[model samples]
Target: MLTPYLAMFLDGRGLNSVEIGQLLALITLTRILGPNLWANLADRSGKSLRILQIGAALALASFFVIFIADGFWGLTLCFGLIMMFWTAIMPQMEVITLNSVAGDAHKYSRIRLWGSLGFILLTISAGRLIDWFGTEVLLVICLALLAALLLVSTRLREPEQLPDNSPHTGSIWSKLKSPVFLGFILALCLLQVGFGPYNSFFTLFMKDLGYSGMQTGLLLSLGVLAEILIFLKAGRLIQRFGIKWMLLISLALTVVRWALLAHFAHLPWVLIATQCIHAASFGLTHATAIQFIHRYFGRRYQSRGQALYVSLAGGLGGAVGNFGAGLLWQQGQGATQAFLAAAMVVGVSLVVILLIPSRHLECASEPAR
Candidate 1:
C-alpha cells in the first residue's frame, strides 16, 4: 500500500513529478546509511529482533507526521526519518527469514510467497478503497499496517542458531574486494537503477493513459501473481539452470520487459505482458541476490551482508532510478524516454553480468559461486 500508492498520495497533495521522485530518492538514500548503522549495532548486541522492533516503532511514529507535513522540506523530513528506521526493519526481516529457512534458498521462497499474497490482497483492496474513498484512504491504511508491523515484531525471535557454522574470520574489507563481490554489487545496483521509472511513476503514468485506479491495481497485482509463481519454483530453477544462468535469464528478460514498456505501455496488453515478467525482474532477481549473499557472507557477518546488499543495490541503485526517472519523465511528457533509458541501463547490467566469469560454480548446471 505504501510504496505503490506513495507517489499518488504525494501527487494528490500537489507535488510535481520531479519532487515526488526526489522524495522517493531521499527515502532510499537513507537505506545507504541506516542499514549499515543498524546492522553494526545488531551484530555487536545480538539483538536483531529488538532493533527491528525499535525501528518499526520509530518509523511508525515518524510517518504520522506525513499527515501534517507541508511543502518539499516538510515531506522530506517526514519520509527521510521514516525511511531511516524502515531500512533497519527490512534488513532485519531478511536476516531472520533467511536464518529460519536454514540456508535452503529454495525454501525461502515458500516463506516469502506469503508476502506476495498480502501485497496482492492489499493492492487490490486499496485500489477499490481508493476508488470509493480517494487516495487519502492511503494514510489511514498505511498507519494501520505500520501499527500491525510493530505489533508483529514484538512476537518475533531469533533462530536457535544461525545457519552457517563456518567461522567468518576474514576481514569484511578483504571479502568486499573480491572480483565476484564487486561484480555482483555493481550489476545488481545497475539492475535496480533500471527499475527507477516503474517503481516511482508507473501508477501515475497509467492514470495519465486513462486507466482507472482499480485497473491499475489489478495490473500491479498481476505482476505479483507472476511473482508468486516464480517464488514457488525459484530454488528448482536456480538449481537446474544455476544462479549464473538464472540471473542471465532474469536480466535479459528484464531488458525486454522494460523496452516493451517504453514503446508499448499505452497499449493495455503490453502493460499486462510487462507485468507478467515481474517475476524475473523482481522475484527471481531478489531470490538470486539472497542466494548470493547467503553464500558469500558467512554466519557471523550475515546481517551485515544483508544490510550491505540492501543498502547498495536497493539504496544507491534505487536512488538513482527514482531521481533519474523523475527527470526523464519531465512531468509525464517524456514517459517513453524514461522507460527507454531504463531498458538501456538494464542492458548494461546484462553485459556486466555476462562478463562476471562463470567459474567456481557449485554444480555443472548452477553457478552457485
Candidate 2:
C-alpha cells in the first residue's frame, strides 16, 4: 500500500530523484542494523511479542513525525526513525510463524499467504485512492495501518515451541564462517541488488511511460496476485522440486522479467505478462529462503538467521541497489539501463549459486510432525 506510492509522495513533496533514492536507501540501511539489534534482545529475553509491540508503538510515533517533515534531512530523519523500529517486525514475525507451525514447513506458506493478500488489497486500493485523492493521502493510510499494527501486536500470543533434539551449534559466527553458508548469503545479497531498481523506481518508471496511477497499482498488484497463487501452492512445489531447484528457477525468471521490462515497457501486454514472474522472483524465492534459513541455522539461531537475511539481502543489498539505480537513472541512461544493470547483477548471483555443490543446496529433512 505505502510502497507503490512512497516514491511518488516524496516526489510530490519536492524531493528530486536523487534525494528520493537517498531517502529510500536510508530506510534499507536501518534494516541492516535494526533487525539484528532487536532480534538479539528478543532471543535473549524470550520476549518477542513484547518487543514487537514496543517497536510498533515507536514506529507509529516516528512515522507520524513525517507529517511535519520537510526537505531531505527532515524526511530522512523521520523515515530512518520509523524504519529503525519497523524493520524489527518482520524477522520476529518470521520466527514466530515458523515456531507456530512446528515441523511442517509447508504450512508456513499458508500462514504467510494472508500477508500477501493484505499487500495486494492495500496496494491496489492505495493506487486508486492516491489517484483520486493525491499522494498526501499516503501518510494518513500509513498512519492508520501502523496504528492497526500496534493494536494487533498486543494480541499476538507467544509462539508454541517444538521439541528439539538436534545438537546445539557452537555459535552463529562459526556457522557463518563455512564456505557454503557464506556463498548462500552472498548470493542472496546479489539477488536483492538485482531487485533494487524495480523496488525503488518501477512506479516512477511506469508513470514516466504515461501509465496512470490505477494502472501502476494494478501492475504492482498483478505481481503480488501471482505471488499469492504461488504461495497457495508453494508447499507442494517445494516438496517436489526442492529448494535449490526452485531458487534457480526463480533467479532465471527474475532475469527474464527484468529484461522484458527494460526493453518493452511500451507494450502493456508485455508489462502485464512480465508481472506474473513475481510469483517466481519474490513469492517462491522468499518462501524458499525462509525455509533455508530455518534448516541451515537450526532452532537455536533462528532469529539471528532471519535477521541476517533481512540485514544483508534487504538492507545492504537494497540500499546499494537503490542508491546505484538512482545515480544510473539520473545519468540519462534511462530506466532500461538501470534494469539491465540489475539483470547483470543477478547473472553474477546465478554463477555463485551454481558453484555450490548440489548436496549443500538440498532441503533439510522435515522434523516429526
Candidate 3:
C-alpha cells in the first residue's frame, strides 16, 4: 500500500516530484538507522516478538500525526517518525519466521507468499479507492494496517530457544569481517541502489505515461503476482541452480527489466513483460538473500544479520536510489535516464556478487531442506 501509492499521495498533498523523492529517501534512510537500534536491543533481550510489537505500535502512533502535518517539513518529520519505527519491525520478524521454520527455504517461501498476496490485494483496491475517493484514503488504510500489525505481533509467540552449537561462535564483528559476507552486503547494497528509480517513481512514471490509477495499481500488482509465483518455486530453484547462480540470474533479469522499461514503457505490452520479471528482480533475489544470510550467520546473531541486511542493503542502497532517482528524474522528463542509471548500478552489483568466496557456499551443490 505504501510503496505504490505514497508518491501519488504526496503529489496530491501539493508536493513536487523532487520533494516527494527526497521524502522517500529520508524514509529509506530510517531503515538504515532504525533497524540497527532495534536489532541490538532484541539481540540483547532475546525477545524479537516484543521488539516487533513495540515497533508496530510506535509506527502507528507516529503515522496518525500525518493528518495534521501541513508542509514539506511537517510531512517529512511525520513520515520520518513513522518509518523509523516501521523499518525496525521487519528484521526482527524475519528472524522469528526463519526460526519457526528451522531455516527451510521452501517453507519460508510458502509463508512469505502471504505477504505478496496482501500486497496484490491492497495495491489493486487502493488504486480503485484513489480513483473514487482520493489519495487521503492512503492514510486511513495505512493506519488500519499498522494497527493490524501491532495486534498480530501481540498474538504471535516467539519460537522456542534452541541450542546453537555450531562451531563458529565468534563475536558479531567476526561474522561481519568475513570477505564473502562483506561482498554479499556490498553487492546487495548496490542492487538496492539500482532499485531506487523503479521503486520511488514507477507509479508516478505510470501516471505520466497517461495510465490511470487503476492501471498503475494493476501494473504494480502484476509484478507482485509474478513475485508470488517465484517465491512459490524458490526452494526448487535453489535446489536446482543453487543460491549463487540464482542471485546472478535475478540481477541479470533486473538489468533487462529496467532497460526495457526505460525504452519501452509506452508500449503497454512491454510494460507487462517487465513487470513479469519482477519475480526474478525482487522475489527470487530476496528469497535467496534471506536463505543465504540465514545460513551464513550463527543463530545467536541472526537478528543482527537480518538488521544489517535491511540497514545496509535496503536502507543505504535505498537512500542513494531514492535520492539519485529524484535528481535523474528531473520532474519526470528524465525518467528514461533514471531507469538506465538504475540498470547500470545493478550491473555493477552483478560483478560484486561474484566476489562471494567458494568456500562458504551452502547451496552450491547440496539440496536445500
Candidate 4:
C-alpha cells in the first residue's frame, strides 16, 4: 500500500527522480545494519516479540514525523529513521513465524499469504483514495496502518518451542562459507538489484504512460494477487521442483517481466500480463528463499541468518539497484533503459542460481506434521 505510493508522494513534494531514488536508497542502506542489530538483541534476550513491538512503536512515531518534514534532507532523515525501525520488524517476524509453525515451512506461505492480501487491499484502496482525495492522503493512510500494526504487535506472543533436528551441522560461519549458501546469497542479491527499478519507479512509469493513480494501483495489486495465488500452491510446487529449479524459474521470469515492462509498457494488456509474473518472480522465490535460509542457518543462528539475508540481499542489493536506476532514468527513453538494465542484472542472478550444487536444491527434509 505505502510502497506503491511512496515514490509518487516524493514526486508530489517536488523531488526529482534522483532525489527520490536517493531517499529510497537511504532506506535500504539502513537495512544493512538495522535488522542485524535488532535481531542480535532479540536472539540474545530471547525476546523477539518484544523487539518487534518496540520497532513497530518506533516506526510509527518516526513516520508521523514525516507529516511535518520539509525539504529533501528533512524527509530523508524522517524516512530513514522510519525504515531503521521498519526493517527490524520483518526479519524478526520471519523468525517468530517460522518458529510458531514448527517444521512445516510450507505452512509459512499460507500464513504469509495474508500479508499479500493486505497489500492488495491497501494498494488498491490507496490508489483509488489518492485519486479521489490527493497524494497527501498517503500519510494519513500510512499512519493508520502503522497504528494498526502497533496494536497487532502487542498481541503477538513468542513461539514456545523452536525447531530441532535442523539438517545443517556446522557453525554459522562454516555454513556461510559453503559454496551453495554463498552462491544462493549472491543470486538473491543480484535479483534484488534487478528489483530496484521496478520497486522505485514502476508506478511513475505507469503515470508517465498516462495511467491514472487508480490504474497504477490496480496493476500493482494485480501483481500481488498473482503472488497470493502462487503462495497458496507454493508448498506443492516446491516439493515437485525443488528450491533450485524454483529459483531458476523465478529469475528467468523476472528477466522476461522487466523486459516486457521496458518494451511494451505502452500496451495495457501487455503490462497486465507482465505484472502476473510477480507470482514467480517474488512469491515463489521469497517462500523458497526463506525455507532455504532456515535450512542453511539452522535454529541456533536463525535470527542472525534472517538478518544477514535481509541486510545483504534486501539492503545492499536494493541500494545499488535504486542508485543505479536513478542514474539511468532520463526524462524520456530513460525508463526503458533502466528496466532493460534491471533485466540484465537479474540475468546474472540466473547464472548464480545455476551455480548452486544440485543436491542443495532438493528438499532438506519433510515438514514435521
Model 1, 1-369: lDDT tens digits are: 679878888898889999998988988899899999999998788788888999989989887898888988898888889889988888888878877877787789988999999999999999888899998899899899999999988787776664345433488888788887888889999999999999999889988999888988999999999999999999888777777888889999999999998888888789999999999999999998888786677767778989999999999999999999988888889898998999999999888889877874232223223
lDDT (10s digit) by residue, model 4, range 1-369:
577787888899988898888888887899999988998998788888998999999998888788889888998888889889997799988989988887365688899999999998889898899889989999999889889999988887889855467756777789788777788889999999999889998888888889898888899999999999999999778877788888999999999999998898899888989889999999999998888887667778888889999999999999999888877875435998999999999999999888767786564434422
* The 10-residue segment with the lowest total lDDT in model 4: 360-369
State, as a TM-score between 0 and 1, how close model 4 is to the true structure: 0.96
lDDT-best of 2 and 4: 4
Q: Candidate 2 regions off by >4 Å? A: 331-333, 363-369
Those runs of model 3 whose alpha carbons end farther than 4 Å from true positions after fitting are 361-369
Candidate 3 residue 308 C-alpha distance from true site, Å: 0.3
After TM-score superposition, the amount by which residue 163's alpha carbon in candidate 1 deviates from its true location, in angstroms, is 6.8
Model 3 RMSD vs true structure: 1.8
Lowest lDDT sum, 10 consecutive residues, model 3, at 360-369
lDDT of 2 at 305: 83
What's each prediction's TM-score?
A: 0.96, 0.96, 0.96, 0.96
Residue 363 in model 2: lDDT? 34
